[model samples]
Target: MFSPQPQYNSPHNQGVVDGIISGCKSFCLQTSIHGFNHIAAPKRHWIERLLWLVAVATAVWGVVDISLGQWQRYRENPTVVTLEKDFRTWHYTMPAVTACVQNRTNQDKLQNAIKSRWNVTPESHPTKYLYYRRFVDVVTSSDLYHLEGYEEFANDPDLNVDLFELVVELMPEQRVKLSTAEQITTPPKWTPVMTEVGACYTVNSLAITDVALV
Candidate 1:
């Protein structure tokens, strides 16, 4: 008669099994996903664990269903292009155009404005003139990214320059005419608007509050 075989459930084997179970429990507790902890808890009843399993399955199914529906829709209608024969007769609105002048500021006008406002010329008050010039450069320069340092000048009403007036005073005198369908039409009025780089002018702008018959 052969001796009884040694038991397969050795201490080392049992320890490895326990370690796996402990790792799974720790993962369930620390994970951000909901319902996993309830399923893994040792004190939870069988019925409660079953309910959590069903809930998690339902949520996963919902996400998968929505993904499939979107994919089907894309496959059905990938893209559509329609061409019109009489496209010339169709009415089309003119596109708005914004223009920024190369010469953003006029030195002569700035000097005059500063002298008129403070009653002091650059020659007499060199410090004050330099301060104003620095403010203007910070506001008008396109390369300067951070404006936090210039908050004082930006917030001060006394230092603020009339950007629109400065740009208009130096604007070159010119006439604009529009022609459409071999007929002369009046061009859209240029509206003054302040932008990141100082005063800019826009034509056929919807931002204008007062609607005009063009």
Candidate 2:
């Protein structure tokens, strides 16, 4: 009788099965290369936390930089830009005027500076609006003009200067902010104050101080 000895599984086969099981367990613990799976939660959470921190820090730095006024570049040139804006706003509905200015303080070197420094004639309107407006405001100062002896020309230099100055600093300078008079009604609170007889005044009394915050 030929007895067939049952073939016994070799150690090599057993080893191969063990290796496959170990590999499968390693893949599960680390990552599944071939199937849809989940990433290790701890590593994912760490990355998210780092990103959130960086975002918050960036936002805080941005706010601080703006508050410090470190980014201000054109702030110094405000006088010119502001004057232009006010000119456009005020004259939008009204007819524009020609204005002239002479240096009252430079009396010693009058004729020389008048020729070199002054571009516009005493009563003639300059072509440039910005220059004309500023010249008018400064030349028209009551005291300054009085010294320049141009007071004979009749115009409201004082009132004009005050208004021009007021407009220039209205937004940035606290002193020039719109007065309480501005908020109350349509018409302005104070009219141009008249000097005793014929002279012009620059600024008038505040009809509305309520606009200011102490």
Clashing pairs in 1: none
TM-score of each: 0.43, 0.17
Q: Judging by lDDT against the true structure, name the best candidate.
A: 1
- Model 1 lDDT, residue 128, Cα: 80
- Total backbone clashes of candidate 1, pairs 3 or more residues apart or in separate chains: 0
TM-score attained by model 2? 0.17
Clashes of 2: 3
Model 1 residue runs over 4 Å out of place are 1-84, 87-90, 142-184, 196-198, 210-214
Error of 2 at 4 (Å): 74
Cα RMSD for candidate 1? 9.7
lDDT of 1 at 201: 65
Tens-digit lDDT track of model 1 for 103-127: 5556657677567656667899899
lDDT of each residue in 74-93, candidate 2, tens digit only: 47565664565654334222
Q: lDDT for every model? A: 0.65, 0.39
